[model samples]
Target: MSLIYVLDILGTFAFAISGALVASDKKFDLFGVLIIAFVTAVGGGMLRDVLINAHPINWIGDLNYLFVIFTAVVFTFLFKSKIAHLSKTMFLFDTVGISVFTLLGLEKGLSYDLHPIIALIMGMISAVFGGVLRDVLTNKIPLIFQKEIYASACLAGGITYLILNHFHIPENIIFIISASIIIIIRVIAVKFELELPKIKDDLFTKK
Candidate 1:
């Protein structure tokens, strides 16, 4: 199998596990957990595929994607206690998922002849909206709606991919660099409590 395909599967698995953990934290039943896991794993990709008119949505096109997500849910069930003991397990998997998804989405968009700017937007959406859906389902605000620098990091990585591609960098190297840029930006932002500047509430009130 191609490296890119493998990475995509890994990202799906990570996202599924992240969603399953969140559902478990909310005391959701098995059916609820499965729904969240499937959505988190492939919701963004399915949206992207629809927007691009790609026939057969990602998970539908490849049964392996469904298998991976199912395996992830089972893994979470079997090792819930052990996984919970790890520091920031959900955060770690979520970060990895976004980083990988961002690049893959960008490439897919380009393959469909989308303009670079639009492709970058597609990449950001693919990396972020699954989490947004997950949060909305759980009655929490999405991270991107907060000052949290989530979609911004995906855009940064997408830009990095474009620039590197322009310079004729090796595809493997570009993939590694772009994915690392997303992960690094996310990790540093969270560690330092960094955020996009917000408008003061007083400004609106005064107006």
Candidate 2:
């Protein structure tokens, strides 16, 4: 397989594992865990494809995505005990997955001649909406709505990729740099507990 395909599979598996972990935290059963894993793996790609009119979306075109997600669910279940103790490590994995997926999504959007701004938005959605869906289904507020720098990191990566691409940088380099930027940003933010300002309810109170 090509390196791109390998990276894609890795990203998919990472996403699935992250989703499965969340489901486990919520005390979901095997079926629910698998469902979350599958959605987290492909939900963003499906949405991007639909918006770009790239119909017969990616997972539908290739069964390997499903296989990867299932494998991830199984692996996560088997390693649940070990994984539960590694919350920081899991967050790192999740950060990497989101970064890689965001770059892939932006590449796909650019390939379809989408505007750069739209492509950046698509990339953020592709990286994050799956996690949002997973959290919502499990009755938790989505991370994007929380003070975490989640989507912002994805957006920063996406914009960096677009800027680099505009300068005629090679695709491989663009992917690496963009993904690295996201991973670094996420790690630093988590390490320092850095977050955007929370909107205070008092600011919106009627006089």
Candidate 3:
């Protein structure tokens, strides 16, 4: 099939594994692990589809998406010990997942004739909200709500993509550039502990 479809599936699988890993860390049972995996795989995309009124949503159309998540869950189960030793590798995979999701989400938004700015937000949401959902389900604060650069990285990538598309860059090249921007941002942020400033809690504290 098309490269976009391939990337989408790859992102789904990556995110599914990420979710399963989180569940494993939390000591969730098998069913709970599977639930978190599926949620993280499609939570963002489903939110985007619903907002944009995409018919039948994404996974509902093919159902093969479910198989992808199932594979991720099984892989996580079989390789739990191995994966535990690959935390850095998993971080890199998470970057790849968000990068692909951001690009695909932006393109999907444009295909629906949405404004570029709105499409950028859509891209950010698609790249981030799944992870947010995963965090929320795990009883942790969402990364985007923290000082993390999670959503910021997606926004930077989306804006670069919009600018490149406006300049008539080749689609393949644009995809590479955009995805690289996202991953680079993520890598730098995580490596350097770069983060947005949090508002001082004393701002509204009672005297």
> For residues 1-207, could you state the per-residue lDDT of candidate 2 as single tens digits?
276677678778888998898898888899999999988889988888888899789899999999999988998988888876876766666777788779888878878988889888888878888888888888888878987898888988888898998899988898888889999998898889899877776767887
By lDDT, the better pick of 1 and 3 is 3
Per-prediction count of colliding residue pairs? 0, 0, 0
Ranked by lDDT, top first: 3, 1, 2
Query: After superposition, which runs of candidate 3 have C-alpha atoms over 4 Å from their true positions?
Result: 201-207
Give Cα-based local distance difference scores for all models. 0.87, 0.85, 0.88
Clash count for candidate 2 is: 0
Alpha carbon lDDT of residue 100, candidate 3?
A: 88
Clashes of 1: 0
**Residue pairs in steric clash, candidate 3?**
none
How much lDDT does candidate 2 score? Answer: 0.85
RMSD of 3: 2.7
Cα lDDT of candidate 1 equals: 0.87
**RMSD after Cα superposition, model 1:** 2.4
Better of 1 and 2 by lDDT: 1
